[model samples]
Target: MEFGLWEKYYIEILDDFGFSREGDEESAKLLDEILSTEGCLTLNDLGEIVGFSDKYIVFGAGPSIKEHISMLKENYDLKDYVLVAADGATTAMIEQKIVPDIVATDLDGNIDDILLANLRGANIVIHAHGDNIERIASLTSFFNNVLGTTQAQPIGTLYNFGGFTDGDRAIFLAVALGASEITLAGMDFGDIVTKYSRPNISNALEEADDFKKKKLRYAEKFTNWVAENENVEIINLKE
Candidate 1:
């Protein structure tokens, strides 16, 4: 998506979360410099990998991810579609021995699982934001290859795929890559947050705090907007 088009939502997100636009820009600059070093995948490289696939399934961290994938596995041949996992959803997919083609994360999820997937040949789509500057510094060095992105602005090799939460952002990435058909899985946007969504919770379900719920709502809204504006077909497994 164009920076001009995505700017409004970026500003709204900043206001909603009381986040810093300058801080986001700084983080993006950090990530851009890091990814521009030498061997990291450029935006074109990411597009090349994702561009070949016509259909995509983006897995969110909602509770039903495992079950949904399991059911799909039994009925359909998943090789036809590109698989993208959103942050902590990597754990669920890894546990099921399903290595996704791409994993989009802000580095807040289980680092070990994310690295393990990277080692096992998954392309990491790493995002930079206000809070994760140190994370982008310390952790990005471990990855062999990464597709860097930012919500703020495009700088160097960084891109603005145009969504907020990891789940919606993954969808945006797919859209940017020319996916004609996109399927949503384990993307419940309701009030209850699962352990997979929250990352390593002892309890199965937890009540989402106001901010968390609001983010989910925005995720849903953005997906809908993209579906309409981009004219991509949406297969909502949630419904």
Candidate 2:
């Protein structure tokens, strides 16, 4: 995505949600400050891992995921597809013994489970932003394989592949890696709040539900943009 479009979306997010962009920049700076002993994983490296499968299943932390997990397990064979989970959904998937091939997170949800998944050989794509810079420093070294990301700008090791939240970013990642087909599960953009959402993680956001819903709306918009612009086929499992 072009920097101009990124700037456009940044302003849109701010206007729509009534938040400051300063935090996002601060988070990126913090991520830059926190050095990792392990070398950075480039987009080429991620592409190599993702290019193995043309089909992909991206799991969001929406409550509907709980409803579909049994059906997905019994009816759908996931062996032919690459499985990706957004942050908190990692724990939900792991609880059912389904380990994702990639976990896209801002470290706002459950870091321990994501770390466990990393230990279990799942690729971790950690997003750096203002709210969770401290979390990044505390957990970055524990994972053997990690890809850095930032919403502000790509500085040094941190890259911007586009998309704001983890769910939408997961879709952007699939597109970036050249997946031919991308299927979504638990990506509900409704008013119902899921337990995995960061609103439950922190009390800093005063209007949590409004904030979460707005983010979800933007996520849907961003992912839809990826679908419209790219050749990739995206299907909502709920549909």
Clashes found in each candidate (C-alpha, N, C closer than 3 A): 0, 2
lDDT (10s digit) by residue, model 1, range 1-239: 67898898888889889999998999999998887884588767877776657899999988678788898788868888889999989988888898888999999887898899999888999999999999999999898779999999788888887999999999998988888999988998888887777865578888888989999999999989988899689888879
Q: Show where candidate 1 strays beyond 4 Å.
A: none
lDDT, model 2: 0.81
Instruction: State the weakest 10-residue window (summed lDDT) of model 2.
Output: 199-208
Report residue 56 deviation for candidate 2 (angstroms).
1.0
Write down the worst ten-residue block by lDDT for model 1: 43-52
Best by TM-score: 1
